[model samples]
Target: MTTPAHVAIIMDGNGRWAKARGLPRLAGHRAGVEALRQSVKTASRLGIEWLTVYAFSSENWSRPPSEVSDLLGLLKLFIRRDLAELHRSGVRVRVIGERDDLQPDIRLLLEEAESLTAGNGALNLVIAFNYGGRDEIVRAMRKIAADVEAGRTSSASITPQTVSEALDTNGIPDPDLVIRTSGEMRLSNFLLWQAAYSELIFLPCLWPDFTPEQFEEALRQFSVRERRFGGRNERDVVSSSA
Candidate 1:
């Protein structure tokens, strides 16, 4: 089975999932963690090279204080409890987003996770916390501007590659498949710049309900479609599958 080299997911509807069950909102976030773990194992089994998930967004902080606290608490526990298992499983962990304002302990946890898994080669797992696509682009532009000001780079010589290297996902390949759960069609500022040509899959299942079977279905859907970057396809002469 030929799978896309990189896959990105916007895990949504955790709160809704809990509300539907008459459980507390935190109950939903906790269940979402389980879904995330299952996803990692499933993706690794399917031979996916890169898996990126939107764990938290820059806009998420605007939520209620208690909810934000619970989310961060879950993040802390995930790293503290699951980091060792991830290292043993050969998953390279990368956290993308701003960190300067993060709690000192959380910053250390992220750094520790990255350092421990830096040499692993199995599957790359990226957690986008406090990340926004537009913010990422602006951040990249600021970096490029600084380089140009320092006379290290010329503005006229800049290219797409130059800007890409400055973004939070500098070392990561752009996602070939971007999946948004809970039937959300919008990107929600997840990867605006990098998803220029990604094949998108929107599943109706909530994040907590996303299972391996659903994942396989998405991949199977991807396998049959022909990916032609913008230009006309040769198969168009007889038939087209888009």
Candidate 2:
């Protein structure tokens, strides 16, 4: 079977999903977590090497205090509950974002989870919590500038590869497929630099209701497409099944 080396998702419409059922927003968020668990299992079974999810954006801080607290609480619970199982299943967990804003306890848990699963080889699961693409780019640039100032590298050597190496996803491959639930067409500032040529699949299902079948459909669709990567002809594709 054809499998994407990496897949990224923008899990959206949780608020709407909750409202439609007369449930609180946090209820939908909780359901989203269950969906995420299923997605991880399905992706691993399907042989996907890497998966990234936009769990919380930098802009999410504007939400009400109660909601923010609930989200953070859920994150803590997730780490505590899933770390052992993930490690056992050979899934490596990594959080990519500005983690200084997180609570100290939460930070500690995240660090521990990462360390525990660092040697896993089944799948690399990246959760973008409090993450922003623009902020990531700026952070990368700042690191590069500091290195250059320290005479570690010359300005002429500051290529795209150099910038990519400084980013949080330094050792990870760029996503081959980007799926956004709730039918959103925009990137919403997620993986701006890395998703330049990714195959985008906009799903109509809300994040809480996303299913493995839907994910399989996305993969099947991706398998049929001829990825030219900006080239005009299908000949550029190394393998085209359809």
Candidate 3:
């Protein structure tokens, strides 16, 4: 099957998965981390060049303070424990989201991961932490306005590409396939602009239960999709006429 060049995941249902099993939500979060690792390995093995995962949203900060701390702690643990293995596996880690308000230690840890794995080329792993697609667009717009204010950019000359370049995912290509777990059919504030034409797959499995086989199944579904990118398929047109 033809593999997608880039795949983004809305890793949902961790808390629910844990609740269903009578385990703590933090346990679900930790299990999701293992699933994430499996996903990265699976994508790499399948020759997917880019994999983006929604780790945390800006709105997630509204959760209980203890829950927020637990999530942040899990992130720190993952970086510390798995970063070296990721580096050795040649994965380039990149984080997308606002960083100005992050705690100094967390901010430094994220930067270090990016800097350390920046040179790796095997597979690009993008973690969307403290991210919201609308917020990302707003931030990009602010950046563009800043440049225009300084006379370095012209408002009249701004194009979609100009706005895209201002985004945190500026150097990254738009995802070809977006897989959302736990049967969620919405983007839930994911890559709103970049995913204007992305093929979406909603799976029944929770994030914690996601496995290489599940990832492969998602890829299999994507392989047969007719991604015209806002255009009509010739075969479809012919079929309709017949």
Candidate 4:
């Protein structure tokens, strides 16, 4: 089977997971973190090279202050608790988003984690915190514009590849498969350009309830897809069968 080189996930329905169990939302987020840990282990064992998760979106700031604070605390806790083990396991952790919006300590921790795991080569795990697809695109555009103004690049030379290189995921391959849990069909402004042709899988299970089996099932389905990438139909199957 052709294993995907990169996989991205939009973990959804945490609040609903808590509501169904008569628990606080924070409890669900905690469970989600546990799920994330399991996912990392599973992905590594499956030989997937890159995994990117949408942990928090820029629009999440509209949430109640208390909830936002709890989320930030959880992020810090995850970094502190998992960074060393991840480094040891050959998992390089990276955070992609606007850093200025984060607390000073959290920003420092993010930088430290990135620096510590920079040498690892097993699995590249990226967390999208305080991230938005539109924002990322805008940031990339600004960068390209700056380069053009500095005479480093000309407007006539601008291309899709040029814009992609300016984005936060410059070195990473585009996700081959993107999974969103809780049966959500919308992309929610996640990885807009990067996921342009990615195969999407929507699972009914909530984020916390998602298991390794479900993840495997998604891969199984992904394996059956005909990824033509807008190419015309070909008779390769018939020719090979002959």
**lDDT by residue for model 1 (46-78), tens:** 999999999999999999999999999999999
All candidates' lDDT scores?
0.94, 0.92, 0.95, 0.93
The lDDT leader among the candidates is: 3
Candidate 2: Cα lDDT at 28: 92
| lDDT of model 4 at position 149 | 99
TM-score of candidate 1 versus the correct structure, residues matched by position = 0.96
Which pairs clash in model 3? none
lDDT of 2 by residue, 108-176 (tens): 988998999999999999999889999999999999999999999999988989988998888989999
In Å, residue 38's CA in model 2 sits off its true spot by 0.3
Candidate 3 residues 42-92, lDDT tens each?
989999999999999999999999999999999999999999999999999
Ten-residue stretch with the least lDDT total in model 4: 231-240
Q: What lDDT tens digits, residue by residue, belong to model 4 across residues 162-238?
A: 99999988888899999999988999999999999999999999999999999999999999987988764468757
Rank all candidate structures by their lDDT, best first, as comma-separated numbers.
3, 1, 4, 2
Candidate order by TM-score, highest to lowest?
3, 1, 4, 2
Which TM-score value belongs to model 3?
Answer: 0.97
Global fold similarity of model 4 (TM-score): 0.96
Minimum summed lDDT over a 10-residue window in model 3 is located at: 223-232
Better of 2 and 3 by lDDT: 3
